[model samples]
Every structure is written in structure tokens, then in C-alpha cells.
Target: MKLTTTSRIAGSAALCASLALAGCGGGSGSGSQAQGQIVDGGTFTMALNADPGNLDPQSSAASALFTISQLAYDTLLGVDPAGGQIRSQLADRWSAAGTTVKLTLRKGVTCADGTPLTARTVADNLTYVGDPKNKSPFLGTFLPAGARAAADDATGEVTLTLAAPAPFVLNGLASLPIVCAGGMSDRTSLAKTTAGTGPYKLTEAVPGDHYTYAIRDGYTWGPNGASTATPGMPDTVTIRIVENPATAANLLLSGELNAAQVTGPDAQRLDKAGLFAARTAAVLGEQWYNQAEGRATRDPAVRLALTQALDLGQLRTVLGAGQATPPTTLAAIEPLACPGGTLASALPAHDPAAATEALKKIAGKTLTFAYSTAGGSAATATAELAVQQWKAAGITVTPKPQSGEAINQTLFGTGDWDIAWAQVNVNSPDQIVPFLSGPGVPDGTNFAGIRNSEYDAAVKRASAMDGTAGCATWLEAEAALVKAADVVPFANQQIATYGAKARFETPGQLIPTSIRMLDR
Candidate 1:
């Protein structure tokens, strides 16, 4: 389940304080100056950094897809942004016994097409995602392996049976977006159309341009008892894809856009302009080695050597603009399910001499390095620096740059590269289990092709425990992977979203239930 960090709550508090200050400083008798006043019936426009590849939740794990999917779909459970508590959504309440979980559907919920949301529908969603043949990236990441869902239509209850123990079963269910029977039956149509029981319904979609959603009136079931009838809730929401951060910032300043998440110098300028800012911490520097045959990174010593050659501290400073934190785990993003001393003694040390010695057996070997240009110039520069560091250890490197979409295709489809830099942020440690210990690529999330029996055994031990009780075992398992140089995570940074002509709350992305239209 997604949990909120203290830092995220603090960021929201700070934004509220700034809004309060703005209210106090406004001119007398101005209607727009009134704090907490609910003004309804206006369109809220948002600027997005990339075109969401597909609207289908089961198709890909791209961040853009997740953000947009929320507008049209509701999950079995909702996660509180302030605290990581599992809140009721479509399911009114739930209980678990051993590896079986039973959820009772909330009464009076209906899909966008007017069909009643039943236990059978929920069961269908679970079964579809649990199947590997579906090629859903969420198979093992969100839906546990060998999971079977059965529905009791008369009682409106759905039971989930897991093949093995999963410590974070509820959290995984909370992340799975439920699809209607019609949508499930016709998967190809989901790329453009939506069929969900959410607060908003997708009415218009223009790929590469914008998407429009209209409020679903009389909708009372939402995260934390939220409703579409709440005062000041926008009548219509529009998401415009603007790839350039500066262009998005300019649109916000010109009053053409209400909100946008931005970074770099543009963020500083927006901050000075008194725009509302919400921040969430996420890991930015993560490198995964492709262990498929014939790849130079397949050798453990070479992987260890490549890791040891770089000065991580210097790299963090350069890549993070001197503001990023040292990552503690793959699930570094907040409301962290398992947070502890995982990094202090686990990561490899920076030593060029040691790296050179380790690479002596394979000196002059050439490897292709892949990275995305989505983070702008900073990411490109960081990859270049890594190449130089590897060269110092007597390794030949060829750098390949790809757009964000292209990177996902190349990494998951072609599997043509030796090493790749990508972000693997998730809300819980359990979400990353598939990526760390499982079958490799074409079949599992373990893109690195890593298979360590000791690591797998440690994870199995941790899975039997509950919640934070498993933190120690989880950390130990991660340490085993790091000590072997399987994966390297360097920097974590606070990503900020800026707003103007609107006031809203954001835990990570824009909260659909908390959005409000300004009295402009």
C-alpha cells in the first residue's frame, strides 16, 4: 500500500501556510481572497510532461499511465496520502486469514456503463492480472504469483487465495486498478476507452494532445469518504501533454494551465512567484545490469568492478544538484513500507584501484550503456560521467540515448543492452520482490537475470512475517544482493509539482478527490 512520508505531509503543510499567507495579503473586498471558499463549475487544466502511452492499466507500468489511469478507475482499496493506511474504496471492508483474503464490495457502486460493480467483476480483474500470458507488468509486482480469485455473487464477497505467503497482500490489492467486465473482455479498446467506477469519466481523449474527463455526479464512494459532489470540485478536468518543462511553466504563468510538475531552474522561478508546490522524494540514480548471455555485465566480478569504479558521492552531488539524499533501498519513495539501515553498510565502496584489479581478467571488454533522456541534460551528463568512470577501470563503453518510451521498449522488448539506468520507485518493499528475486525478463520482472538462492530464501522468510516486522529480514536480503553488485542505487531527490490559478493537495501526484477550482 502507498504510505505518506513525514516529509510529504510537511510539504503539504508548507503549501497550505503559503496559501493562507496569500489570503491575508490580498486586497480588501476581493472575492478571490477568501480562504477555503468553494467555487464550482469551472474547468481545471493540467500540464503533463509526456504523452501517456496507453490508458490501459494492465498493459504497462509507466508512471504516466498510472497517473492518468487514476482519473477513470478505482481500486479495491485506497491508500491514504497522509498516512499509508489502507482505506476502503470499492471494498467496504476486508479481512485476511492465512494466505486467503476476503473483500466485500461496497453497496450501490456502478461502472461508467451503468453495470453494477459486482464481486465477480473484482474476481475477473484479479484473475486477469494474475495470468502471465496477459503480459501485464503488474503480474508479480502488484498481483501475487499463483493467486486465484473466487466470487460469491449472492453475498457480494470475493476471496483471494495465494499460492505462497505474501506479507503485503493488502497493499498489493490496493495498487491493482479494477477493470469492468466489458473492458476486460475487449482489451484492445482499453488503450483509448475507459470503463471504471471512479469520480470522473473519460469523455474525450486526444492522444499526444489532451484528455478530458467530466465529473461523475452522485459518486459518494472515494478515498476517505470523498465525493464528486464536494463543493469547489471541478466540473471538468483536462490534461494537456506538454513535454517541455519550461513551456509548461510558461503556460501556468500565462493562466492557460492550472498545474504542472516541473524541475530545474524553472521550479525555482515558480517558487519565487508564490505558486503552490508539493514535493515527493524518489530515487533518481539506479543502474541495472542485463545478465543475459554474452553480455559483459553477466560476470559478477565485472558488475562489482563497474560499481566500485565510480565515486558515488560525487555522482550524487552532480546528478542531484547537491540536494539528493543517499538512497536506502529500491523502495526509497515515501510512506516507505520498510525503512531502516539498509544502505549504510550494504553498498560497494568507491575504489578505482580495486575496480581495475577486479576487471583485470576482462580488460578492454566493450559494453553498451543505455539511459533515458527524459530527465533532460542532467541525466545525459550523469550517463557520460559513468562511462568515463568505467573507462578509467579499463573497460570500453558505448553510450546509447533513448526517449522514455523508447527506453521502456528497448529494456523490456529488445533486451539489447548490457547496462541501463532507470528509476524503480515503488510504495513498498514487497512491490520490488519480483524485480529482485524471480525469473528473468521475457518471463519476470527480474530484468537483471539474477538468481541467488540465498537471497530468495531470505525473502521467503521475510514474506511470512507481517508489516514492519519483516524490515530486518528484507534489509538483510537487499544487502545480499548489493554485496554481490547486482544493482546500484545512488541518489534520491524531492520532485516538486507547481500550481497557479488553482489550489489543490498533492501527496505524490494530484489527488483527484482533493482538486479544487480557483475563483479566477
Candidate 2:
């Protein structure tokens, strides 16, 4: 969840210098950063591994919807190119004090419907997401749970009052997309199209296939003063819902796809082909256990036993197709806010005997292991491998392979899975705290119903401190969860979004304002 619920790219895309296309040697750092001359007037086609299903910006933080939201919706703040610094987007000026945050909307900003986006409307959007009754996924993750907002049009400022202090409040706000009041009132309208103040607007919606967006005219407000009026920005953007990685890779190579995040076996060849890529670190393998009452995994002993039974090293290797690296912390998105090792000391060592003994006491119960199929072939293979490993320890695990949306529904709605392999990739630790501990699904985004007092206490302490100043405590909380076998994060690796005859920034996902159509 960083549920960024963007399924992690399952193969390694090691960065290596190459004589890429005819003119591009590759711009440094993700290669999407503009360097020399930039071209204009073209289409940038990309691959969406899965259809977003619902198009509401605030409905879910799942990767598919989140990626597209970055195109059609603009947040009040944004992560700066240098990282760690908050830059202006919809709000030209913003600040936080204690539990209160204020954002002054930029003048001359108009919604896609030509309605002026005042501070009052922006405040309403935040209020909609913060309300637990609305069931918006961003509730606890981005906006603090129970947070409320009020705006004054005359002052052009919106004030947010939080239920509790949040260390990374501004950072979380950067990821929260604001919708116009019209769409907010009629939520169903957003399920098909976009309604936000961003550089792009959704012009066509074709579910399970592709969605088309046209660049907004006279749009000036963007991440740190970014503009759609910039030269080389595509006139139209198309996101094709291509589930198969091999087909997507083939499209990338043949110039049918302008950009795609390829992490399957084809990544190696794509590197050799010298396609420009926007690369970033992502958590490829993370295991979660549903600790709801009556569930076998509700027992810590069973959860730990299950974790100990599997050889995580082999699992990591299988998950990444042999190119994965050990995850240093829970958050893998760069620039790492808490950059210190915290996963190993806490994780249970692989000991099959202990697992076998624990299982001996708890017999005649089978576990439902689930994972999203959108993770490509490597993820599927990794899931099967895990089942075999569990079976070895005398644990019977029935695999529940489902589409991304289906699995999300089970976790957040049905509570049908005993264990899941989901990657919630976020840059900040605060964003993940809600999932680790808080109100469980149905009402909140805490899908697993994890109730770890240590993690909760540590989060409370860390939240009082400003920003990363509480990193030690924050990381301690992460380790506490792992130590308790609350969750297991096994693999992390760099994933590249290759661009063919195009270039774009993916700080985490693609930045709409950063996309540049290159003339090859």
C-alpha cells in the first residue's frame, strides 16, 4: 500500500549506460529528466497493467487508479524533484502547525468544467476523503482519520484540523488528489471519467481497454509551477489496459507503446535495446496475514510459524526472477525518508522444525493464500512456490488467485483471505501506519485487521515529532511488527519504466507534467 496497490514490477531492471535510441543517450536519473532539446505535438501511449475499474480519484489508492489519477487530478502539494522538500501545486502557499495545516489556493485556477476552484471547494474535497462514512481509501492513509477541513473563499485558504498530530502530513497531502465539488457531489460521475484540476482531462473512457486524456489548455498550476503549456508535452495521452507483460514489452520494442514499466524476463532485452527508462525502487514481495478473529492466522504463533516455514531468500529470488534485493525497510519509494536497516533483526529466521511443531498443535485447518494476478508471471510463480513451501511445513494452503480488484475486495470487503502477498509501496512511513494499525476494512483502509500495540504506540510517539525527526521510532515500529510476525517484507528492487521515443518522470508513478514526447 504505499495499498499503492501498483503491483510491483517482478523483474530486475538494473541501470546500465547504453547507446539507447538514435538521438537519446538517456537523461540521467530515471532518464525522464529533460536535458537537451524537447520535441512537441505527439501522443504518449502507456500500458496500464490493469483497468482502474472505478475512476474516482479518492476511492482507492490502488496502483492502477493512482497512476491514472496523477494524470487527471492535481494535489495541493507535490514532492519536489530534489526530494524531501514540499512544493506548491494547487495551493501556492501552505504550512502546518501542530495538528493544523493551511493551504492557500492559487488564483486563476479553474476546474475542467470551467468552474473556479476556490479554497472552499478544495476544503470540501478534503472533508469528503476524511469522513469515515464516505469509505474513501485515503481516509486514514493520507488525511488523518477524523481530520476535518474548513475554507474561506475571501481568504483563499483552507484550514485542516487533524484528530491527531501527523509527522508526514504534508507528504501525505502531496499524494491526495482533489476533485471538483460537482464530481464530489455526484460520486458516480467519477467512476467513468475524471474531474480534477490537473494538466490533463479524461476525454474518453473504455473499461478493460484504454482511457484517453487531452491536455488542458491554459493550465498553469502544476507540481512546483509545472505547466501543460511546456513544449514537448504530449497533446494526447492514452493508457492501454494491457494485462500481459510480454505483450506490453513487445509493444514497447515495436514502438506501439511509447512507455511501459517492464519487469518481466523482457526487461533485460529492453535494457539492451537502449530504451530510456524512469527507474525507482519498489517493494516487490510483502506478505500480509489477516489477523481477524476466528482466522487461523489470528494466532501469533501460527503467523510466526507460517513465516518461519518458508525460505524467504528463495522466495525473494523467485519473486524477482533472481534479481531482487533484500528490503531495507517497509517503505521502498525514494528518496528513503528513513534510510537505515530494520527488517532483518526483527524477521523470524527460517526454521522448519519450529513451524512443523506449531502446525502439529493446530491441525485440520487450511489457509487461504491470495495474491493479485496483475503482478505478472513472476508473482504467479512466487505464489505457487510459497504454497509448496507451506505444504512442506504441514500447512495446507489453498491458493486464491484473483484479479487485483477482486483481491482488494476480499481484503477490504469480504475478509476472505487468510494470507496475502500485497505490496503497499509508499515513500513515507506515515502513509503505511494506517494499514498496519487502525480501524479494519469496511470502515477504514486497515484491510488486514492488524492490531499490534507496539506498532500503535511507536506510531503515536513518532507522529508527535516533526517529519523524519522521529525516524528511529518510526523504523522501530516497523521492526516491532516484523518481530511479532505481523507482516513480512522480503524483497525490494529497482523497477524501470522504459520509454520508446518518449521521456517522462516517475517519482513514484508517472508525473503527467513531466511527460515529454521525443521525436525519434
Candidate 3:
């Protein structure tokens, strides 16, 4: 049920001619460059499937648009846009001693409104995210402990004291995008105005319609990973929200868009036009089975059966061109993506007969496999397909279409689900323990409600180990989780970037550490 609508549209003859007429130059390598150097002044037209639900940084749950917002806002730290490795942004230098970490902030930094970026502001941001009074959902994945944050205004440094040793603390800090404390007074308004201190500044944002960001004029405050602000390619970048594939394709054909995300059959149409180029990125997709509720899926056997019945090949075909990949491991398509060995290699193949037998064991219990399709029609269709496939295995899965907010509310809020599908972020094994371990890693994203002591122990060991040894230990933990049916990771989603053939190069996901515009 984990659904995504973004797809790459590349290599179109008509697109190139259109770009030429639009004065975007007549080059055929539009989808290859990273630093899109179209010069400044003209508005960069872009598109998104939906609007981001929140922008509080602490309460924001829309994963799709957070990165986009990150461009306009500055996090305590940033990651390479292409590589996704931790890099400095606001913090100048950082060190860890046991569970306490100290961060020294770079001086003379200013917010978009010209307020000095102070250590107190840094502490406030963390304190806000960590505060129970705030009721921030982001707290679950971050700030998990008897953690304390304090800033030394004189030294321009902030120190975090953790209750226990948390190795991935930097990763968590990297996620807290800083916004002007003054502008954030109205939390609702923050969503529309992505106020922060980064290369780009928000100019306009109309929910579900479009958003605009302009380069911060005369701005020069970047960490080691970023180049000095060189006036972002399109002086003004406009994101047009289009959810339908055909309409997005049609818009591209009419030259209304410089970049568009195309998927399914639409990719074929653009490719046949011979004017668009495509680049594929991978995302881990999971068929989240809610085990907390009193449902037939609470039995691990039923969950295992459903996992085994999934036909990765069929899912890919249904997913259409450049939409998916059959994941071999928890880290599937990541560069550091570990295969988890042959033991991990022995993933259950699609076996309807075995699945049918497994379902018979729990014949009396009715199963409800629930999923939400609020983001777009693609998710709704994907959920329906899962329902049909599961029915073939003698399991009755009722596919439901709720708004993304409603579905997330039920799954993460009330836990009122027999089964729901989602995609888990397993970028590192260090992140696995909280997802699989005890009574939910407090404020953790493991919404499946799994609590395994042995798995927790294994994850701790893996997190401490260095190099390949750590990966092996994580592999063990992954196996334990899979065997326990804690989570059923079915496939890895492919990140598709589409653009006009001669306009610019399309980088998959922009690395936060480095802000590189494609086809510059």
C-alpha cells in the first residue's frame, strides 16, 4: 500500500523544441546536469502532486515535500543532496562524549528576516521539538530520551545531553530545519511560508496549487558541503501541483512545464515522443500490517503468509515503467544498500498455494488490510491491486481509500487498523533498532507496534560495531524482525525524475549537504 506518484519524464523531441522556443537553449542533455545554470531572473516552473500538510519542522509529516522546504530553510546540519551523507550547515563543529553532544554554531548567521541565528534559537528549536507540551509527532523519531538542550549564547554553541548513548544523534539533528522563531509564532502560517536561513527563500505558497522560492540575494552562509550561493538557476522556481499522469504529460507536451514527473503508461508516451530523459532512484516500500489491533494479522503466521504471497514481479509490472524494483534486502537500492547475504537472499517468493494453506490455519478470523490513497490515484490503484492479489490466497483484504492524513491519523494516532501499508526509511542499520526493538523506541516511527527483546539486543550490537561487521549484525536483526513478521517489506520504490529533453538535467533527490540544480 506504500504509494508514490513521482516519475521521471525524459528525452522528448517536442520538449526540446519547446524549450528552444521558450529560450531555455536547444541542448539535448537537459536531464544530466546537476547545477542547472540557466542563469537567474526567469521563473523556474516545477510541479508537485500535492501540498505538504505541515511546515512546523517539528510537526511536519509530509515526507515528500520536507526536502523541498529544506532548500528554503536551514537545518542544524545538512546532507549531501546526491549522497545523503551528514554535513555541517548551521553547526560549525560537533563532538560527542558518551550521551552528551556539543555543537558549536557558526557566527554571524542571519535568518531571512535578519534576526541573528543564535545558539538560544538552536536550543529553542530543539526544545520545541522535544517538548511534550508541543505534541509534536516528529518527537517520536527524534529526541527519544531524558534529553536536555541548552545553549551558551557567548560561545554560540548548543549542547545536547541524552539519557542514554544514541549514536544516530547527528542524523536526528540533521533533520531539524531552522525557521525564523518570530515568523513561527503562527504555526499554521509557517506551513505556507517556509521561513528559514538557506540559499533559497520562500516567496509564495498556495496550498494544493503552487509554491514559489527565490534565491536569497547576497546570501552567503553555507557549511562545508555547499558552494557559495551563485544565484540559483531559475531566479524564481514555481512548483505546479499536478496529480494526474496524463494531465502532467499533456502540460509537458504543451510546453507549460519545464520539468514534470511522469509515471506508468505516461512514461511510454513521453519516451515515444523521443524528447525526455529518465533517472531512477530507489525507495523502500512496505506493506504495513497493523499487529497491535485485534485482527487476524496479529498472528505472525498470517502476516508471513501475506508477505510470501506478494509477487514482486507482478507488482513491478503493475507499478509500470521506472516505478519500482524488487528489493533484495532491507536497504534495497541505496548505494550502501546491503543485500543481507544469501540468508537474507532467501526472501519468500510469491507462492499462492502456501499462502492459501497459511490462511486456512486462521480460517475463522476475518482480515481487513487497510490502506490510504490520499496523495493521488496511484496509491488507490495500488491498494486495490493488493486486495485482489491477497484475495487469491484465500484472504479477504478490504482495501479502503482514505485521505493520507486520515490514514496516518488512524495508524500513528489511534492505532485503529488491522493492516496498513507504508514505506519505512532504513537508510542505516543504526536506525533499525528503534524500528524493531522494545515497546516502540519511544517517539519512534515503528508504528507496527512491535516489541522484541532479542531483536533489540541485536540492534544495539549492530549499532556499536564498525564497518561490515555492523552490517552483518544488522543483517541478523533484520532477519529476526522479518521472521517475527514485525514488518513485511515487499518492494523498493524507484525515484523517477522527468524533465524537458533540452531544458536541464534532472538530479534524482537533491542532496541537502550540497544544493545542486540539475542542467545548470
Candidate 4:
């Protein structure tokens, strides 16, 4: 794989929009491994924090969609966990120069419908998403915006002509869940059915309950050419929806669940239980204040005072249960492409007295605040603490805790919020452009209606360079956002995917192909 833009983007584009708070950024692995003999054909059940309502993988940047997409979709390329290098998946050979990309499809690839995977199908997937009218959320996140595609079936090649230069092009392509020709034809069926040339095929779908998938035979095109026919590979994958972290932890200890992401207070006991884990460091605690018209947070003073009122150090300790670390960047997932920035110096010092004085502008007005309930009990306590801090600063803010789905609607749909805990977790700073500096809701993904001229100008200069060559400028761009109080990133932690009778991998989302059922 060869990826270059204006010399490779100076920083990796946290390209994919992940709505999940935990599974979004940074990369690493820890815990014991290979505890027992490999066991084949057993069911691998993992707990999903929320049900991905829309099954269309290309439609949402929500973490739920990103997680489930891993099971039934295949991307053009992938990123290596240890080295941050590009790896092949569906595409055998691929390269990018400036704004043009070329991909060579591997032979003998087949979709879930038993149809051969062709170059046309690959090109069509890009075309469909590249068209802004289609409104695919992946238009710029995973696939470059306004990119055009051409297919040469005779040679199994798909050529992409991007409208703009992108540094993380190859890495971003690794995250775009490519659709099969059949699914592309009947797009709405994707809402409940499976489509793609992935290692697994969806067998059953019950919203808010469990999603079941069966491993596909003769599939050998996972990241780094991983295969599904290997021994110890699960015959079935079950993603069960369990909202409570403690309940999910209980299920894991009871031998009912093979895997579950247990955060909150429950993680402490699970760690002592000695289960094998695939850990990922991520920016799990973040605050975004809406700066849209008529909102109190729109005022730079209000945004700064709100950020100053709370002691981020204490909140990080509380939110992460005293095990969290200081966050480094806005990009939250693991194996970060350009993890060379700090959110500290840019943040305002905790000053309650100054906050109380600054917030006098909106004396009696109550700000509508929302937090994602997916963070479990710790998140509830964190939001409550924030409310108390704000109140003490002479700020009247209403705290509203919402489920993962409700949080998405509140942020992207109605925009009826003053402050929220939602995040746009990706691996690159360039990928954050849509959420930070574009048109607001009803027009673009910039849900908060942010208007940071410094961030906009800095990102332009940074995005012009390739690879980490422009690292300083990219860091400058991130600093602009934080220094202006447009976003408040507080805690980073080792978000672990605990395994009971199983072992897996998590670069960002849990790798479906890396799961191995164990005979304990």
C-alpha cells in the first residue's frame, strides 16, 4: 500500500466519525493472552452498549454502527496496530499520489450473496458515497469528499480521483465499510440485512436485543489477508445489547459472555477477575459547548467560564474512576496516526471565582446540558458533578442524561442542547474538520455551529503537508480549538474489551477476524 498527499497529509485524519465515547481513539493492547487451548466453532458473544438503529454502515459515524460494521463489512485497506502502517484488506495492491488513488482487487473475492466481488462494485461504492446528494455520512469521514471513481473490470482495478488532497486517504479507506452490489441496489434493505464481502454474514437481526452472524467460508481477505477458515475461529458472532456495564460484567463472569467492554466501577473487579483483554487507550471524557445562535454558550466568555467552573482534574479522576489519564488530542481512538499534541496548555485554569463573575451575563438563564448515558454510572456522577460546579459558579444549567441513540438525535437532529458530552472520535485531526468548522446542523455535520477562525486557518496549512511532516501545524490547529474553548477534552483511559473464554484485538473497534474462542 502506498499513500501520499501533498507530500501524505501532515497528520492522520481522525477520518471516521465515531459517536461512541469509549471505543473511539488511540491504540494499544494489554492483559494476559492464550490462556487455554484453542476451541473452534463456539459462539462468540460480545455486549454492545447500544443498538445501532440504522444498519446502513455508510450512513452514520456512530460508534455502534462502526462496531457492528466490522462483522459484516470489508474496507479497501487497513492499518497495522503496532506500526501504524497501511495494510491490505479487500484491495490487494493500492496507492495514492496527490489526489488520485488506484486499487487492485484481489481475485476470488465473493460477497455474502454468493456473487463474485468485482471492480465495478468497488467503484460504485465509492461513487455512491462520494456524491454529496446521497448524504452518506462517510462522504468525507472515510471516503474523500467529491471523489470520482472508474473501474477496469478486465484488470480488477478501481481508480479514484479525489477532489481534494487528503493525508489519511489510505487509512480512512480502511474504515469505509464497502457495500456489495446487492446491498447497493437495494439500499434500504441494508437497514435490516447484511451486505459486503466480509468474513461474516448476518443471520439474524433483532433490534435492542441481539444481532447474530455466521462466519463465511472460503473468506481469506481480512486485514493482512486474515481468513475465516482458521481453527478456533468462531462459527457464530453474537452482539447483544446490554446497557448496564455492571450487568455486562456480571454476564462475563458468569461464563455467559465471551467478551464485554466493562468501564465504570465494575472494571475494577473485572480486572481482578483476571480475564484476557484487548485494551485501547481513548479520549472518553470530553465536553462540547454549542455556539449556535441564541445559545448562552455561544459567547466566548460563557464557553470559557463554563469550562473554568469545573475542575477537569477532579472530573477526569471521577469520570474515569481515578484510572484515567490526561487526554492528548481531540482524536480519541487507538493506534493514532499523528498523536503529537497536548490539550493542556490551551485549556483554561480552573477558577471558580472568575467563572462566577464571567457568567453574570446570563444571570438567571438555565442552559440545557446533555450527557451520554452509555458511560454508565460514572458518567451520571460526572454530569451531576458538572452541574454542581456550574451552579456554584452562578450558572443555572439543567442536566439531561440520554441514551446513546437519544444523544445522537439531540446533537445531530434537533440541536436542542447548550452543552453535550458527545464526541467525534477518529484517528486524525483532518477528519475532525466536518464537525468543527463546517456549516451547522440541517446543512452540514458541524452540529455545534462552531466558528473558530484560528482553527480553520491552522487546519488549512496543516492539511497541505504529507504524513507527519506537518505535525506542528496540525498540533497548532488542535490548540486553536481548545484555547478558544470550542471543545474541552478532559480524560483519556485504557478502554478495555474484556474477554472471558476468548481473546480479541481492538485497534479502534473490535476486530471481528481477530476473535478466537478458547477452551477454558
Candidates, ranked, lDDT: 4, 2, 1, 3
- Give lDDT tens digits, candidate 2, residues 1-520: 3353335111111111000000000123444322435788688899866667789977776677777787888888877645467778888899898889999988999888898898888888888887778887677667887788999999899999988888878877887888987897799999997888888899999998899999999999986678888999999999998766667789998889988876756676777777787777777778889999999999999999999999999988876777888878876677667778568667899999999999886788888997766566777788888899889999899999776656666777788989987777766787777678888877666778899999999988988888889999989999999998898988876777888888877777778888878776
lDDT of 4: 0.76
Cα displacement (Å) at residue 277, model 1: 1.4
Question: Per-residue CA lDDT of candidate 3, range 214-250, in tens?
Answer: 7665456665635334433446667776655577777
Candidate 4 C-alpha error for residue 235, in Å: 0.7
**lDDT by residue for model 1 (425-514), tens:** 566777777767777767866766887777788888888888779988988887788788787878777666666656765444456777
Q: Candidate 1 has which clashing residue pairs, if any?
A: 1-171, 3-84, 3-335
Q: Candidates ranked by TM-score, best first?
A: 4, 2, 1, 3
For all candidates, what are the clash counts?
A: 3, 7, 35, 18
lDDT-best of 2 and 3: 2
The runs of at least 3 residues in candidate 4 whose Cα sits more than 4 Å from the true structure, single-residue gaps closed, are: 1-34
Candidate with the greatest TM-score versus the true structure: 4
Residue ranges of candidate 1 with Cα displaced over 4 Å: 1-38
RMSD to native, candidate 2: 4.9
Worst 10-residue lDDT window, candidate 2: 16-25
Model 2: how far is 53 from its true place, Å? 1.0
157-194, model 4: which lDDT tens digit per residue? 99999887888778778778889999999999999998
